[model samples]
Target: MPQDTIPNPILRGFNPDPSIVRVGDDYYIATSTFEWFPGVQIHQSRDLVNWRLLTRPLTRPSQLNMLGAPDGCGVWAPCLTHANDRFWLIYTDVKRYGRTTVGGASGASLRDFHNYLVTADAIEGPWSDPVHLNSSGFDPSLFHDDDGRKWLLNQLWDHRPGRNRFAGIVAQQYDPAAQALVGERRNIFPGTALGLTEAPHLYKRDGWYHLITAEGGTGFGHAVTMARSRTLEGPYEPHPDGPVLTARDRPHAALQRAGHADLVETPDGRTWMAYLCGRPLPNRGRCVLGRETAIQPMAWGEDGWLRTRDGSGDPELAPPSPGLQPAPWPAGLEWEDFDGLDLPIDFQWLRSPFPDELFSLVARPGWLRLFGRESIGSTFRQALVARRQQAFCYSARTVMDFAPAHFQQAAGLVCYYGASKFHYLFVSRDDEHGRHLRVMSALPDSPQADAFTAPIPLPDDGLVHLRVEVDYERLRFAFSLDGEAWTWLPEMFDASILSDEATAPGAPAFTGAFVGMACQDTSGTGLPADFDGFGYVERAYAAKVG
Candidate 1:
């Protein structure tokens, strides 16, 4: 507790389900990226408080393919560790999302999940391709024992009609020599009795094996629980003091749904826990930014139990910093001139590979050329490149040099939350109106799907400037032929349409909100749109106390 301040969320915006590890004085953490390319996001930190985005593993299309992935189905949980002097990563790919009667009973649904592994000689890869593992369940982690033995720990899914969807925690012996998990998979623990047990991680300390799990279904009920045993595999005893950490019962807490924790011991003999938490909108309780990564300091008691700094089982906004100095990185990018050969690290695409043929910087120097593909909301091929919306109040702008010759071709700025909900400001050529500019607010499966503004006739110069100003409550659109003179649209639509609570009753909204450029060539003739520049600015918004 020497340093003055400690930023709680080491990594911000959509970085959830953190797993941390230490190699000498350096530390590394990885998080999940569902349906987004560059499957696993890795970050490096010298001090536990300040972190930097290092690199993303699962870069190749062969390693990750989200072609037909649904809203929240792709990569699940990623567990990163340092074993055998190399960095090892284990993650799950959730393919299908539907009801199933696997084993639990009838009317029980389970996702089709698969586990895989990849390793690198150093923290920054050259990472190896994935090695297929069993699909027993999701959130697979690798635990190395003292005697050079490897084991894989994950959740066992139970589809019985009346049983818990998350059955229990299981571990199987993995042979490094054979590069496969051999021997029988043993059910070590039946969860902490809190139910919905998942995201299990094992560690050995003080001659005892410690296990951690996330329970209570990832919403306001989410939490972190712990158990320990004398042996690696046995009847583990749950912590007598209830959940080691959680915010589910504390409705007025600053950080909500704090769970899915992973611990790391620094070289200076300090312990910290990196977990997932979210800040929801006041009154509505909508988490538009998705789950983010937060850290809490820990201390060991005389009873050999690990607890938070205050032992209240709640997270802190600014915990005491460790020994190292703060070396924070930029939260997100604000502008892009399209002068570089590659997209910035902050940019990402929806459920598709980073198409070299679709988006290009070489095609038009100092500009980004995006070749149109399928329609905007298609789960398959779509021409879109976006970045996560890190804040609720922000302004996004883009200048386009595109003249759609037909109604089937359109290009413009987009606010895409998932497969079902989005808003678009586009320019297209209509049979009756020639080329026109319009705004469409879409929230499919919800009540806001039919909202569209009247089209305005556009000039034929092929140069246009579009802007979308976002506040906490609504979004306003505007356009201009000259950069200085602007014309505001007539409609002010509700911003809550791009939220987690606005989706359909049974749909999943795991990912956060995004804004960027998207185009489509529904006519089967590929058309390209050139964007001269793009800018996004996040303004300071006051937080409402719960």
Candidate 2:
């Protein structure tokens, strides 16, 4: 009998740069959050198909930067590992371009790149405060050798003698017990013989120490390359043919620019790879979901070299195996009804340096209250919004009722990136006007610019449903006083700015552009927005699916 088949994109939306580790029958995965708070997100899955958020790895104010928007900054690709009866996560804290500091600057100041370590006895933590590693480089990954030696693999600027280059890969011994660099760092691999490389992940299997790095930049040309060595310290040999996975040759492949992958073996002994990829709309390259997580099957070739099943190295839209049974669809927690003691695994916040007091999971009964603060630009910085971007096309509907005590208390649904790139469809009451629904937009580097406001007038019934429908490249928004009789909003904004090429650039960054629906009450009056009846439907329309 033929095995049961499931649709392509077992997990959809904005989940990208998936790092998977198996602990017994349970599987855990984490992904990149560029400028989003609660930096690294942890996910738990019984089957590889169904996943739930475990907990955020970074919770302390000292660990994150909540008040500033780190453009193409925040947490990049993170690797999760289980060792010696504990869980260890080593990740990069990317400082935005202009936000970094040269000397002793303050307030959204850019600092040197650094890798931090966090550990917990349980996946659901109480994670320890971040232990800062090297003060330079990005995309830091941790590996444990068979001899029980720990190594840190990272991509740093190649500021050698006269070569003014931006990319290089290095490895050094890491003393996890000491939480510091143990030995001299070695330049294992630089950019490709022809191009640049970043987001290097190291793994050892079958006596080969595999150095998997992303190359060709993070745009449409992104790719994954592999070099292997018998000894961890010796010269590594690049795959004879070149990149093991890429979409360069297959320019028209449905999933474009696949790279930054982590490999794992299922309990059933099947090998699978999870990476970030994006789907570009016609005539546009901006990704709404940004770079998204995708999975592909892996197999050892006749020569014992690992290769993607599709041969192009791009993320395939099909299952990893033909005979594997499809798992049931995972249920998502409703944002309005989220009254649990902890935040759901699917809900991820933006780049917040202090996530603990930035928002509360149980601050109120049946409400996730985010107190507005003036640190970040507007309330965009302090808003506690959670997003699940696992599907290409979806509809997020929410009922936001907030009585702003002050002019700064604007509350509603938002599609947020950093302080610069975000769109919001929300309702706020002015001192003069009762309540009005408005739409706002912010571009990165631009502060509170290009905001076109249209007041949504509702009936006296005191209920309005705001819905945003994403159809590939086009995003259509509608508001209804009642569930039926929807009135489409005339203003439609082009959403290609979310693409990794358009956003991060350079590295083969996980371009899983997340199209999430989040809620926030940014009015600084210390009053919270009362939101209720939040619902999201994945792939609401089959037409023009990404």
Top TM-score model: 1
- The per-model lDDT (C-alpha) reads 0.83, 0.65
TM-scores of the candidates are: 0.95, 0.84
Candidate 2: deviation at residue 4, Å? 4.9
> How well is each residue in 262-367 modelled by candidate 1, as lDDT tens digits?
9998776778899998878775677777788999789888898889878989887788777676566666567789899987777777667657856888899999
lDDT per residue, candidate 2, 1-546, as tens digits? 333432444445556677888898777888876666667767666566655666676767877764553456667778898888999888877664442333342222333577888888988877888888886677788888778998888877643434424457888998877888888988887666646677777787778888888888666777888888887765888887687777776866777768878888886667777777776666675566667666767877767578877565556766634353443345655444656666555566665555544456566666556655443334345654646545556777776555554345566666655545566776656656556677777654244455756676544336666777766556667787766777778876655554444443222233344433343344434665555546776765443312
Q: What is the Å distance of residue 443 in model 1 from its true position?
A: 1.8
Clashes of each: 6, 43
Task: Give the range of the ten consecutive residues with the poorest summed lDDT in model 2.
Answer: 99-108
lDDT for model 2 comes to 0.65
TM-score for candidate 2, residues paired by index: 0.84
